[model samples]
Target: MVARSTCQPRRGFCFFMSAKRPQSGLLAGRAPTVSADAYHWRMRYQRIDLNLLVALDVLLAERNVTRAAERMHITQSAMSGVLARLRDHFGDQLLVPVGRTMQLTPRAESLVEPVRDIVLRVDSALGTQPDFDPATAQRHFVVIASDYVSRVMLAEVVRRVAAMAPGLTFDIRPTSEIMLGELEQGRADFLITPAHLTAADHPQEVLFDDTYKVLACLQHPDLAGGVTVEQYRSLGHVVYQNERGINPWFEQWYANQYGSTRRVEVITHSFTLIPRFIVGTRRITTIQTRLANQFAQSLAVQIFDPPMETPRLTEVLQWHRLRETDAAVQWVREQIVAGSHAMPPI
Candidate 1:
């Protein structure tokens, strides 16, 4: 399920946690707890709404309701209402109009620099900085990963994270065309992607290198001991495509090398769906060997080495350069890398 909370940016950070899979490790089934220091801090600020600090900073900086509203993505009237609330809260006419222009009052002027400093301090405190502690952190992580990675690795990742920090939650989103935007805008904490899809600026490390295997239903008649290049291209294929009509990386590479293409009988957004789709059909899909082995355990899927030579699939863990120094993010990256290494190779 997804968790949602509301407040202004930086003042009160909010996110959703969607881990449909079972939690792993020793911390499974236990309720998350807040540390005593965090509990006491919450109590001290029980009546204080920190969101107003953001409005105050903007109001003082711009000294114009419309501009401040534009900056805050709120309406001018709403900004005026925030000013009114600030006036009541601070007992000061924070802004005074001098003809057509609004000027900060003496009290507002006094608060201007301090408000900036306080907001900065609070943001630094709330951020996943270099001093982050996973043991007691109430952190939320957003990761964009392919279905294969999510199925083959996310469970283990969650297990490790839960074992260390029960209070942390993960929001794993599917890989999409706009994935880079999510990373650039700080919406996603990390992106698990193949080397071909990696962005230039993001700091990344290879999580694992996997080999591809041809997966088909066990009852497939066309596939016997091994697949030939001709049979592979002639057989109906199920490809993973985030966008309609686009093929998977392997298929594109095959077409480039052989100057021919497979008969794509089905194109689905998820690699996990290929197993179900290929069942009782002649359709064959190329998938990471690790994932193919996983699906073969439950599904009646047969794995085979493809006739054509293929390169090892290197999946990388990438984060926005801005978060490279973040201790929590760094730790999460390390744990994921460790989890990938700990997995038995296929």
Candidate 2:
């Protein structure tokens, strides 16, 4: 056996303490074993109430103590009590009054997104109901959206709804104004909007994506492939308007990027009528393929290669979870899905 003082470490510096083990020579005795209690020593702690996290999230969103308390269906005094408990647990004032209003302290600000995510996770795991059937269903579904999706996608959604559930009905609500009402009443069923809508915009899902193509009356023979900046400017067109709002974002975007807009002859919200209008005039408007094709069937319009730099089209489907399981609503959604699929993939 080697002398204890002269033994070398396995690697690195020999500054560490040498741990002891039973000696190499026929063991005189076995090493003493440790007790299980040593591994179970207690530390200072108290059980935390998780429901407080939900309250804190609501408080942060409302900001006003009274309003926050109302949203949680709790008394203002109780809200203050919870706020105090939050401050004590965090060891700082989570919110402090500045002038006449409360402002989130640094710690409260950091907890905002995390609290929201946690609340959503808990609800997702434990909150949803388990049954839906359309046969005996009685519910009105409201959908708010752009006219373009209506012409292209909603026609299919409508057709499917009519075919599958003749008893149940839908209120194809137009305009974005109904978003809050639909969400508040739990009435909005399926929505198709860009996926980037704000959280306040409502709960939604990305249904599908589409792209832009130039819609011209087949008779408009002066353009093909890329409609040059000058040629685009020279075309007479029907712009869309909703009580003064410009047509689709594509129109404004194209004008800004190409230096000038097409000469305007009419502004109408009736997307179906645009093709009819263009059919008889020298007007050409760039529109989505959905409406363009719908128009092409009757309006004699030609789909041209989109002028190189147009935004990718996205036809996203969104819906509220309240009626997410309703059978009739689901049939409508499926019809939309199928109808959308029927169109040749572009």
Candidate 3:
């Protein structure tokens, strides 16, 4: 029927009414729902019935209400009601029981692939995708190293960062704990250390290689230029130890080379205090070159060439496999390499 213009301001606006009389429309004897206004008002608020898809999918897969409900973690009665709704919606007996078990009809079988495709499409469109940006990243990085290496290059690292990337920062922690798990589990970003860790521990990079040197008090006439294998053996010695004794190989090599044990008169695990011991006395000390240069400016100890040859020490840069791909970490490695090249020989 034509709508009467209720007294609204718009001239063309008028509500429309369903022309169908009772007993002939979609709801049989119910009142009509018509016009864009009435249709939208009803359509916008209608609750979707998701049970149709659930029951249809389960029925096609299981072909039995009780089994489908068990698969869905619901009771059989609930599934029975769902199956009844599905049958009514499709206007077909989708599943038929024969003898002992149920089977899907042709119509139900045809719906399987299409239903699965629709569910997959919906999932793909709704799933989240993650992105990582370096400039705005506020991530904590932990590096493990000995106090020896830390003292040598850490200041340069910090200063270099301020000039290059003011936004990035790092923390270097020293510990002798087994670190493979720490790196594997994302606890530490990298490690620069002297000890030879096993292969299972972490990925690694060779930072720089170094050899031994003798730093003796310049006042000692015996060590004016360099100490002999004989003089080095006779002179009082200072050894840096990680725990109890210095590396057994270093000790063995010292003995094997000079046919006498090193005169390790004083032993301290702390390298920081070694300079004070060598500076005031006529004693001689053997140490790594980086420590020698660091002490050169402050102490009267003169760094001289070693009288005997020894194996070079490999100072490695190590990290958890996870940090290997990270840009900030890569930059840190590059800076370390650059700064290490400038370090004096041992």
Largest TM-score belongs to which candidate? 1
Q: Can you give the TM-score per candidate against the true fold?
A: 0.66, 0.55, 0.55
Worst 10 residues of 3 by lDDT: 21-30
Model 1 poorest 10 in a row by lDDT = 21-30
Backbone clash tally (model 2):
5
Over the full model, what C-alpha lDDT does candidate 1 score relative to the true structure? 0.71
Ranking by lDDT: 1, 3, 2
Better of 1 and 2 by lDDT: 1
Candidate 1 Cα RMSD (Å):
12.2
- 13-48, model 3: which lDDT tens digit per residue? 111111221110000011222435434523542342
lDDT of each: 0.71, 0.57, 0.58
lDDT of 2 by residue, 101-210 (tens): 99998878876665544444343333233343545543445567777777777766676666555555555766564454444333345666655442354445455676
Pairs clashing in candidate 3?
289-346
What candidate 1 gets wrong by more than 4 Å, as runs, is: 1-130
Clashes of each: 0, 5, 1
